[model samples]
Target: MTALVEVVRSGFVESVHHGSLVVTTPDGAVRASIGDVHSPVYPRSSNKPLQALAMLRSGLEVADDDLALVCASHNGEPDHVERALALLERAGLTEDDLHCPPDRPRHEPAAEPRRAAMNCSGKHAGMLATCVAAGWPTADYTDPGHPLQRAIADTVSEMIGEPIAWTGVDGCGAPLLAYSLTGLARAFGRLAAGTGTPRRIADAMRAHPWLVAGTGREDTVLMEAVPGLLMKGGAEGVHAFALSDGTAVAFKIADGNARAREPILVETLRLLGETPKDEAREAVDRMAVGAGVVTGAGRDVGSLRVTGAVAEALGTGS
Candidate 1:
C-alpha cells in the first residue's frame, strides 16, 4: 500500500493517508502509478464533465457558460445560484423540478440553503434541460432506467473504455458510476484533448473559472494560473486534472481528507515534468499541510507532510 501523506506533530509521525495515483500520457501509456490503480472507486463530482457530455449528446442546447455550470459543483455564490435558476427557467422548469436535496451553500461567509444553493443544482438543471430537449418525462429523471441516465451511462462507458463496474446514487440523488483510477486518468486525458462536448465544456470552465467552483477555490485558482490545464475535485478525496500537453493525473486519498489533495497533485505534476506557475504554486501550498501552518490552541505546531512510497514516486525527500 502507498501512504500518500503523513501528519506530523512535534517532529513525530502522527497519522498517514494511503491512496492510489495514476498518470498517463496522451497515447495511453502508463507514465506512473503509486498504488493499486486498477481498483474501482467512485469518482463523485469529478465525473460531472463527462456527464455534461451526455446532456450535449442528447441534444440539450445552452450557451458555453451554461454548459460549464452544468459541469460544476459550484460553491453556490450569487452567480452560481442565478445561473442555476436561469437554466431551470430556460427549460420551462423551476427549482421544484430539481430532485437534488437542497444544501447550505459551500461558499465562505456561509448562507442559508436554497434549491439554487445546492452544489448539484447545476447538474440537476442540466439533466432537466436534457429531458426537456429530448421530450423525456421530467419526473423520475434520476432513475437509472431513465433514457437520459442510460445515455449518460453509455457515455461514461465509452470514456472509461470499460463497462460499468458499479452504480450508486450520489449525494444529489443522481446516479454515480465507478471506474479504476487509471481509467479515470485516461478519461481526463481525452477531456483535455477535447473532441466535441469536452472541448466546449473545457473552454467554458477555463473562461469562467469562478462558476466551476468559486473565488479562491483550488480548482478556480489553479485553472486561472495555468492556462489550458483543466481540473476537478470530487467528494471523498478524488481529484483529477489534465494538461494541454496531454498529461493527466487522477488519484484518491484513502482516508478521504481533502487537505492532502493539492500536495499530491502538485508533486504529481512535478513528476510529470510540469511545474505550476507561481500563483498556482502558492494556492497549492495553501492547500498543502507541511507547506502550510498547523495550529493548535491558536498557536503554531508541527505540520503534515508526504511520506512512504509516494515520496519516492514524486522524487521528493521523505
Candidate 2:
C-alpha cells in the first residue's frame, strides 16, 4: 500500500509519519483523516481533558478558572507557571510534587517558565491533588493503575463510548489507551455537545480557552474564534476538534511535519462549517506550503483527506 504517506516532492520525499483527527459535538466522531486513525497511537497531551474528568470525579472541586490549567497544553508562559503553581498549592502540594520531567518552557523565546507547557504537568498536578485529598500514594501517580489514572482511563473510555482495546506509555509516562480515531473524535464531540461527562469537560475547555493551550496558540485562537468549540492537538502532526453542532474531524500526516498542521486543521474546520473556505486556505497558506523544511524546492504536498468507516461514522450526523 506504499505506506509511510510521504507528501509528494520535487525529486525527493521526506518521512513525516504521524496521525491527525477532527471530532464534533453530540457524538464525537470522525469526519476525515489519513493513515490508521483506528490504531491506538499515543494521544500525548491531547488527552488532558479526559484526565480533568478524573479530578472532578475525585472530588477536587476546582473552580472553573482552574479548569483551564487542568486541561491545557500551555506554552509555559509566566501566567501558566503561576497558575500551575497555584493549582498545586490549592491541593496542598508544591513544585517538588510535580512528577513530569523538567524542561524549558513551551511558549519559548519569551523567557518561558520551566516545564509548564508540559501539558501533562497540570494534569499530573491535578492528579496529585486528588491523591492528596484521598490520601493516596504520590510516588507512582503516573502509573496506569494508580487511582487517579485508573479513574482517568474509565472516564476516557466512557467519553469515547468504548473500552480501550490497548494501552501504551505516553510521552509523559502516563497510560495511553489505544483508541479509534473516530472514537476519539466522538469523545470530543460529546464534550462539545453531549450530556453528562462530555458536556462538563467541554464547558471547562471552552470557558477557559487560555488553559487549553496558551496565549496566541492556534488551538486557543481557534476555540476563541469559533466559540464553544472542542479542540486538542497532539505532538507529531495529530489534531482533533468537535463543533457545537454535530461535526468531528481527525487527521494523521503520513510523515509528521509541523508544516502540515494548519492546512489539515483548517480543512477539518471548514468541513465542520466552523471556518470559511478562504479562511481555511489562508490558515494553511501560513504553513509555508513549499517551505524548505516541508516539501523540497517546488513540490506541493496534497491536502488532507478522510475516508473509510470513520467517514461513515462522522457523516451519520456530522
Candidate 3:
C-alpha cells in the first residue's frame, strides 16, 4: 500500500489516505507504479469514453460535442441538459427514455432535480440513440443481456485485455465493469495514442473539455489549462488521465474522497518529466487536497498535505 495523503490539524498528523497508482506507455507497458495494480476494481464513470465507442460501433453518430457529452459525467449545466435532450430528440426519443434518475445539477448547487440534469443523462441518451440506430429496444437497454450492454461488455473486455471479474449496477442504474488498475491505465493509453475510434473519442474530449465536465470543474479546468490532456474522474476515488505524448496514469484512493486525485495526477506527470503549464498548475493548486488549511469559525487553525511514500514520490519531503 502507498501512503497517498495525510490530514494535518493544528500541527499534528490526524489521518492518512492509502491507495495504488500506475503509469503506462501508449504500448501498455508499465512505466511506474505504487501499491497493488492488478486487483480488480470498478472504474465507475471513468469508462464512459469506451462506452461511447460501443455506441459508435452500433451506428450511433453525432457531432463531436454531442459525442463528447456521451463520454461525459458532466456538471449538468444548461448546455449539458440541452445537448442530452437534443441527442434524445435525434433518436426520436425523449427524457422519458432515459434510465438515469432525476438529480439536481452539480454545477448549480441550488437547482431543482431534473431528469435531464442527471450527470449520466447524456450517457443514457447515447445508449438510447444506439438502440434507435441498431433497431434495439430502448426500455431495457440498460439490461446486461441487452444487445447494447453485450456490445459494451465486449468493448470493455477488448480494451482492458481481460474478461471482467464483476458486473454491477452503477449509480445511474447502468452496468458497471471492473478491471485492474493497470488494465485501466492501458486502455487510457490506447485512447491517447491509438487511431480511429479511440483517437476520435480523445479528440472530442480534448476539443470540448466543457462538455466533458463543466466550468471550473477539475476535468474541464485541467483540460483547458493543459492543451492535450484527456482526463476523467469517477465516483469512489477512481481517476484516469493521458497525456498527448502517450503517458497515462490511473489510480484509486483507498478512502473514497475524490480530493486525493489531482495531487497524485500532478505528481505522476512530474515523475514522468512533464510539467503542467503555469495556469494548469494553479488550477490544481486551488483544488481541495486531503491535507490543507483546516479552519473553524472562519479562521485557519492548521493544515494538511501529502505525506509518506507518495509524498516522497512527489518530491515533497515530510
Candidate 4:
C-alpha cells in the first residue's frame, strides 16, 4: 500500500513519502508493515547508534556517558552544546576536526534566543573526538573514504546482515548508504537485543539521555516513554526504534509528511502492545494533526488511513 500526507493549507503534496517498513520482535518475529519492508533505503540520522558502536570497538576512549552523545541527534540546547564542547575538550581536540558544516539549530521559535543547539553538533563533536583518539588527521573527516567513515560503514554493513552496495552524501555531508527497511529493522533489533551493541554504546545512551536530545525531543520522549528503549528519527520522515524487550520498527513516509509520522509511529508502537498514556498519546496526536492543529480548530483531527493489502494485514486506516 502507498499513501501521501496532504497539506490542508493548500491541499497539495509538498513532498513524496513512499517506502516500506518492518516491525520485528527481539525474538525475530515479523509483525507488520505498510509498504515494501525489504526495499532499500538510506538510514540517515538513524545510523548514529551504529556508528557509535563501531567507535567503541575502534578503541575510542569515550565514556559511556559520552557514548550516548555520540549516538544522539541533539536539540542543540545550551546543555547539549556544552556537552558537545566538553567532548571536544576531553579529546584535546576542537570543532575544527569536524568536517560537518555548521547549520541552523533544529529547534527554533521558542529557543530562538539561543542558537547553539544544532542537532548534528554532538555527532560532529564525537567524530572530532574519535579523530583525536585515533591520532587521525581531522581534515577531510567527512570524506567517505576516511578511516573513521570506513569503520562506520563497515559497522553499519555488519549490523544489517547485508553488504552496503551504494553510497550517497547525507544532509550533514557524511557518507550515507542504502539498505532495506528489514535490514534497518534488523540492525535496531541487534542493538536492542544487545547482540552487537557495545557496552560503551548502550551505557552512553542510557546514562546521558539529555545529551542525546536536549530538554524535549522525540528521541528523548520515546526513550523516556519506553525506558531503555533506544530511538532515533532521521530527516525525510524516517524513524528507527528498538525496545529492550527485542522489538524493533523501521519506517519511512511515502510522501515525507512529518505530520503523518506521529500516527504511524504510535500505530507501530501500539502494534508492539504499547499504549501511550493520555499525555503521551495527546502529544503524538498533536504531531499527527500538523503539530497541535488537531480537532477542527479545537477537535481531534489527528489520524492515519492505512489502505490496500498491507492495510488488510494491519486491519485499520485513518
Candidate 5:
C-alpha cells in the first residue's frame, strides 16, 4: 500500500491513510497506478452499475429514472424508499421480497426502520424485477446459486475480463464478486465509452444522479458537478468512475477510512484534467474541501489533505 492522504491537526500530521489506485486510458490500458491495483478486492457497491447492466441483459426493463435507482446505493430518504417500493410493485412484489436487512435512512434519523428504507433496497428490488422478467425465482434472488445471481456473476466476470477471485455475501445479502481495481476500472471504461447495454446503464446514472445516491451525497454531488462523469462509491473505501471520454479510475483505501476518499478522488480528478463547471463550482468546491477541518475548542485548527503519492501525482506534495 501507498500513503494516499493525511490528517493534519494544529498543523501537525496526526494520521495517514494508505490505498491502491489505478487510472486507465480510454482503451483500458493502465495509465498510472499506486500500490497493488492488480490484486483482487471486494468492490462493495461500486459494482452496482455493472450489476444493473447485467439485470438489463437478463431482460429487466424499467424507466430511465428507475434504472438509475436500480444501480443505487441510496440515502434511504423518502423519495428513495418510495421509488424502490414502486419498482417492487411494478414487478408484482413487495418489500417483503427484499432480502436486504431492514434499516432506516442514513441521512434522516426520524424515519422508521423498514426493509424498503435500507440503502440496498433499490438493488434488491432490481434483482427481484429481473427475476420476474427472466422467469427466475424471486424468493431466492439473493442466493448465490440463484439464476439471477449466477447471471450477475457471469456478466461481472465478462465485463471485467477475468474470473472472480472470490465470492462473498454483500451487506445487502447478495452475492459479492471480487476483482482487481484494474479490472473494475476497465469495466467502467467500457460503460463510459457509450456502447450498447452498458451505455444505457451509464446514461441512466448520469441522467439521474440524485436517484443514484441522494441529496448531499458524494456520488450525487460529484456526478451533478462534473459533466459526463459516471461515478460510484462503495463501502470499505472503494470508489470508481469513468469520464465520457472513457478514461477510468478505481481505488480502495487500505485502512477503509471513508474520510480519506474524497480528498484523494478530488486530487486524482484534477490530475486527470477535470475542471468543475461554473454553475456547480460551489458544490464541487465543498466536496473538494474534503475531510474538512480539525478544530480545537470549536475553532478551526488544521485540516485533512491529500498527501504522499496522491499528493505528488496532483503536484501538491507535502
Candidate 6:
C-alpha cells in the first residue's frame, strides 16, 4: 500500500491513509495505478450494481426507479423502505422473504430497525423477485448454492473478466465474491459505455441517483452533480465509478476510513479532467467543502486531503 491521502492540521501532517487506486481508460486499460490494484478484495455494497444486473439477467422485472433501488446501498429513508416493500409485494413476497439482516435506517438513528429499512433490503427483494420470475425457490435465495446466487456469481465473474478469488459472507448475509480492483474498474467501464444489459443498469442508476443513496450522501450528490457518472461506495473504504466516456476509477483505503474517500475521489476526478461543469459545478463544490474537514471546539481545524503516491500518479502532488 501507499500513502493515498494525508490528514493535515494547522499546516502539519497529522496522519496518512494508505490505499490502492486504479484508473482505467475508456477501453479498460490501466491508465495509472498506486498500491496493489491486482490483489483481490471484497467490494461489499459496491457490488450492488453488478448484482442488480445479474438479477435483471435472471428475469427480475421492475420499474427503472425500482431497479435503481435494487442497485442501492440506500440511506433507508421512507421512500427507500416503501419501494423495497413494494417490490416484494409485486413479487408476491414480503419483508419476511428478505434475507438481509434487519437494521435501522442509515440516515435515521432514532428510527426502529426493520428488514425493509436495511440498506441491502432492496437488493434482497430484487433477488426474491428474480427467483419468483425464474420459478426458483425463494427460501434460500441468499445461500451460495442457490440458483440466484450461482447466477450472480457467474455474472460477476463474467462482467469483471476475472474468476472469483474467494467467496465469503457479506454483512447482508449474501454470498460475496472477490476480484481485483482492476477488474472492478473494468466492469464499471463496461457498464458506462456498453449497450443492452450494462447500459440498462447504468441508465437506471443515473436516472435515480437519489434512490441509489440519499440526501447529502456522497454517491447521490456526486452522481447528481456530474452528468452520466455512475458511482458506488462500499463498506471498508471501497469506492468505484465510471464517467460517461467509459473512463473508470476504483480504490480502497487501507485503514478503512470513510472520511478520506470523498477527497480522494474528488481529487481523482479533477485530475482526470472529469470535473463537473456549469450549474452542476456549484453543487459539486458545495459537496466537496463538507468532505474530510476536521473540527475542534466547533471550528474547522484540519482536513483529510489526497496526497503522495495516488496524487502523484494522477499528475498532482500535495
Model 4 segments beyond 4 Å from truth?
A: 4-18, 27-29, 107-116, 195-200, 277-318
**Most accurate candidate by lDDT:** 6
**lDDT digits (tens) for residues 1-318 of candidate 2:** 213233434434444334444343454434344455666655556677777877788776677767767777777777777888888888777887787766667646556435545666777777788888877888888887888778888888887777888878877667777676667777676667767755777888888887777865767767776766778887766667777774666555555565566645654555555653354444434542423344324544442322222334346433
* Model 6 CA deviation exceeding 4 Å by range: 277-283, 286-292, 316-318
User: Model 3 segments beyond 4 Å from truth?
Assistant: 288-293, 299-304, 311-318
Once superposed on the true structure, which residue ranges of model 1 sit more than 4 Å away at CA?
Answer: 108-110, 279-281, 290-293, 314-318
> lDDT per residue, candidate 5, 165-210, as tens digits?
9999999899999999999999999999868899999999999999
Candidates ranked, most accurate by lDDT first: 6, 5, 3, 1, 4, 2
Q: lDDT of each prediction vs. the true structure? A: 0.83, 0.65, 0.84, 0.69, 0.88, 0.89
Instruction: List TM-scores for all candidates, in order.
Output: 0.93, 0.79, 0.93, 0.83, 0.96, 0.96
Error of 4 at 136 (Å): 1.9
Candidate 1: clashing residue pairs, number:
0
The TM-score measured for candidate 1 stands at 0.93
Candidate 3 global CA lDDT score: 0.84
Candidate 6 whole-model C-alpha lDDT, 0 to 1: 0.89
Please tell me which model should have the higher lDDT, number 4 or number 6: 6
Better of 3 and 5 by lDDT: 5
